[model samples]
Target: MNYILYAVPFFFALIALELLLDRWRGVSTYRFSDTINSLSAGVLSTTVGLLTKAVGLLTYTLAWQQLALVELSAGSLWVWLLAFVLYDFCYYWNHRLGHERNVLWAAHSVHHQSEDYNLSTALRQTSTGFIFGWIFYLPMAVLGVPPVVFLTVAALNLLYQFWVHTRHIPKLGWFEWLFITPSNHRVHHAQNAVYMDRNYGGVFIVWDRLFGTFQEELDAEPVIFGVTTPLASWNPLWANAQFYVALWRDALRAESWWDKLRIWFMRTGWRPADVAAKYPQSKPDLRQFVKFDVPLSLAQKLYAGVQFSLYVLGGTLLLGMGDKLSPAQMLLGVGWMAVGLYALGVWLENRAHAKRLEVARVLLNLPLTWLAVQLSLLSAGPLLWALLLGYSLVSLAALLWTPRTAVGVPA
Candidate 1:
């Protein structure tokens, strides 16, 4: 599970590296809202990520686990390799449709909405993709790709996608023709008209090149980053809903019912005459929007950094711990972690520094949730009694702080 530790820190290290390299190479990586928005999205996405994993598990077990029609004629290595290729192929279609379809865009646009393209942008994934996502890999299951092999390959393919999200690397010359290079994937993240809806390949750029969706970053018309419909708010939850809601409003505003549905499937920027006349397509110019310094509070930045680090570390640990722990115990532990992290976040937002109290809450949850996990053998009475006492203390503290504005976001 420390995979998150390796992957998440590596992401930040590369992000810092990219900034340094950007200074040397003179590619501007500055965008004012990038850090805050990226971090906010990261928090929201992490909260929802667990829910999607459950959805994936349910889908595989219930629906298309039957689709795994092909048997492994040889050993496990062959099956794993084939699963890798098949999963990538399925991923290719999933990615391609994410760009092609509107409903999918609602889930996926969170990743592309960032104005800055960096390693942090790689972590800006959607929590809602599991809805239609299960469809992409059904072919593999039907072809008889074993569940374990399929899951492993899927994770590996995802791991491969992480590095390409950075802007530090130039096109790998001919390598661009085969693999999905940073250059090509940048097109996937770009907001430029030519770059929009292009380069959907996950591990292979050849898919785009073969499919005629490939575009290169040009010196003359430098690519401007972010969506055509920019996320104008710092609230990450709103970022997930912005486009979908906009589409909904436009659909409602349409003069005809057919025009309502047409707003989605039509070209991305297409809108009803009434809607189009009121809010035109936004053209983002990086030169006008770049901000060099993030200007975060020493306290807030440090707190956010700590929270993000913990999630990445804790997520990786839990991922590996999955096989060893009972599902009940894992769920119990995760619930405590989630609540503690969010409570820590709310406290941090309010500029409250109660680290010792926070630590106590976390430690309390670990043993309690652990007991909850082993409930078959262990009695729940002690755990319940302890939880009641902890809740009472926390509730009293909440009562004392009720006069202060903890919910209103502070500057």
Candidate 2:
């Protein structure tokens, strides 16, 4: 798709623009690793999509069909414009329902995990959105929107969204009324009680204005952006699963089986009494929802980032292999990747909850790393052995192997 070609440059341009605009607005609310984390998640998501497309879950032809349908409409320019409008109308519902449904919320929440409002937040999207998200756009499919045109418009709509993630821009008076300007979208990102679940739109703010979902940005208080239940972690995988794990836990605890299914289908926050009795936490005030600095020392973050970067590259390379490898081979690599994602998510959470799980994440890496090398089917030369040993030992003792976290700080 050469998405990296345009998407990368487009992203960097927005980032530069956001920084300049932030300085102009006197809003300084960005961190290096957090921005990197958001970008990393986006990269991971892109890789996963490539893998799925490779493995055949996502066929390219549906998009082709959607594009071909667009060509059949009468009166070229006017019909294309109408098709674009209709497509956005469908997107508005999809975006709204994403917030209303628990399952969809789980997937969508990844983008909102960051408390900081900046351009990088826009890059963060769920890898899992391919599941059922296509349904919202099916109307275009049924209406015979050319698969190619549909794909192009969808990209344009998404690219439009990237500009709205920043808090740098003030409300454009007339523009605010007509389009999904930065101001209205900032309110959408806000966790404030009054602002939550409002301003659901894709390209045009008119949809939100027309539907009464629009809330103007307030001057009285600043907007605090994030989810109702805080992720409070750096791991991208956990960010995607936080709500989902809660739903699963609730489902298993529910006495009735119906409640189990309903946990996913019901209102985003609805839960059985037993599950509801101890709410996750009350929504945080935007005032108190300040940015968090990672407690680790700079050197540790570098070390961690480096190690994490290797895993990311490994995953990306495996995904890229889908074109070269047979389906069975691709599935084997992807299945192991699924295991790796689960392990990393649990490992990060366990660091906060149970030390053992964190340790297990490292320990498990020994065998996993070996498997990665073995699957490469390369000879166990001294160099390869040394590399494997280094990754395994360091990854296993990542907490201890690093200079700072190595010694006693606290248990």
Candidate 3:
């Protein structure tokens, strides 16, 4: 039923409320470039999922049809309850292995890339998880849980997780013992020595407790958010590819064939002895840690905010119409969106060629709009063309007037 799609509005509303809380408490939890980059990763993940989700659904459906021990009735209340619990149990291991294994961490690290632990951080998801994530849930299919029930519970489990990714919430005393809470989840996100790989349950903390992987949040040792290897940039595409690229480079440099082959499947951060000795990489000093930021002028900030708002709107529309669109149409839309996001990332970085890239993006909108209309992705009309022309002209003016000045600092 695309439950996450339906919850998009509420997600943004809560983010807005969190921003209000930040202002009232005089605490800043979101930075402009960081939040935009986080949301961009999320938007890209959701858009890519529209085309890739079939992999998981089809595999699960085939497994249920062929290997079910017994046919489970979708109408039975017990089936739903059991599936809900079971999905979380599977999710615990999938998430745990995602942190423990190198190849899996390459995909799951997107969620942990954002240094700021805010509501926007929850939306920072992996676009490539579809490749291997479905293997974890095959037990439910084998036990004869219906596909409908599996989908619903999976959505509910994910929906339950969104609210736990904030810093404003304090520990819920007794409530913190059994279920996943904000405090415990914050510990899960922390990169501290004490908190590195603990607390991996999706809905039930009972799984972590039973498996000996739970850690309580401590006031004496405050959580340091983000991964050990900082992402250090606002580019969404690079954020997803950063770890994989590192692993690839390591694999290429290893002297042993066995080391090269096993590097991907080895434990997270395990490098060949040769590679480690030659190209050493060290975790940043916690005491000297500073959040990654880039300077931006006021005009640049306003332009970025307005452009990001448009992408959010466009991405939401694409999601709503996903079922009705052709694959070609979806590909074209997603491709254009990706280019726009990359340009925005460059702008945030204040790169030398950012102005030219942005100007190209603004100009490309006209032909892309015409292509979309011709492809039946958009309706043919004069009003649409007029609106596109007006937006491009305004965007071009802003791009020209906004000097490529690095005077203003990130908020």
Candidate 4:
């Protein structure tokens, strides 16, 4: 069962509730550009996962078949409970090393890019995480926990973490002591020195306490969210690639063969001394921090919102039908999604050719859809074709009519 997909509507509903609470309390935790960028990264991650999920599943299944320490049945409630606890134990190390190591951090940093701490920020996830994340769960497989049980527990653990991403929730008196609550998880997301790299537990706060990584939220020192190295752009593609590109450039610049090779695996944000001296990057002053923003016209904002809604709908449909899709069809869908997201990012950034790229995207949809039909992935019926044509025409009209100078600072 795709548990995450079934929870999609509730996620949005909770986000809406958070917004309502923010309004009633006169607090601002969301910005249009930041929230959209966060959600776009999530959509991209989900789309990419459709292609890469087998890597984790197959690896776990193989390990279980070959290395079973004991046979654990899926139907047993005790097995489910034990697996749930055991998965979080593995997740702690996975998440901790993700912060401590450079390569793993590169894959995990996408989730921390947002300056705003809100429900949408929880959705901000990394597309590249599957590359190494499967390694952390092999112990579960080795113990003979059924794949179905492990995946279910992992999904439930993830869903539990979502509600803790909001600023609206304060310290949960007794609950905060045992489980991850909004207060401490906020501390985990913080860039402030004292709070940085503190909490690493997934479901239970007990792991952090036992492992000596726990830090209670300080009332005197407010938490400032985001990574020390600012992402600085709205592009989801760039968000995933920027850290790796920085490391790659540093690797090339390093004079020694050892430094070139070791730099990729060194601590997060660690650059070779020579590279650091020759091409320095300044650390941002937390006291003077400002969130990244770009001006957008009202029409542009409305258009971006409308188009994003369509992408979400398309993503949900893709998720529902993902297993039935061929690799080529999945690739085709991801290609369209990537292009659409990049164009939206351009619009949000108010780039000079934003409108042109958007118009081009609208036009390209026809060829993309025709290609899908040619591949036998999509229906070639007249009604489907008519709908596609109508969609393209309306989108093109909207792009053309959207005002150029309705620009103002985002709220």
Ranking, TM-score, top scorer first: 3, 4, 2, 1
* TM-score of each prediction: 0.72, 0.77, 0.98, 0.97
Per lDDT, what order, best first?
A: 3, 4, 2, 1
RMSD of each: 6.3, 5.0, 1.8, 2.0
For lDDT, the strongest prediction is 3
After superposition, the stretches of candidate 3 with alpha carbons farther than 4 Å from their true spots are 407-411
Q: Flag regions of model 1 displaced more than 4 Å.
A: 1-6, 19-33, 63-65, 258-267, 272-411
lDDT of 2 by residue, 1-411 (tens): 434435766786878887887688787867755765676677667656755543322343454454444445544676567668878998899889999998988888888888788888888888787776777877776566665566667777888888888766678889888889888999888888889999888889899888889899999857877777877766677676778898899998887788888889887988887766754546665555556444555655565456555656665565445456655555555555555554443333324432344456556655655665556633465676687677767665665654433322122
**What are the Cα lDDT values of the candidates?**
0.66, 0.69, 0.93, 0.92
The true-versus-predicted C-alpha distance at residue 253 of model 1, in Å, is 3.0
State the lDDT of candidate 3 residue by residue for 243-311, as single tens digits: 999999999999999999998989999999999999999999998888888888888889999999999
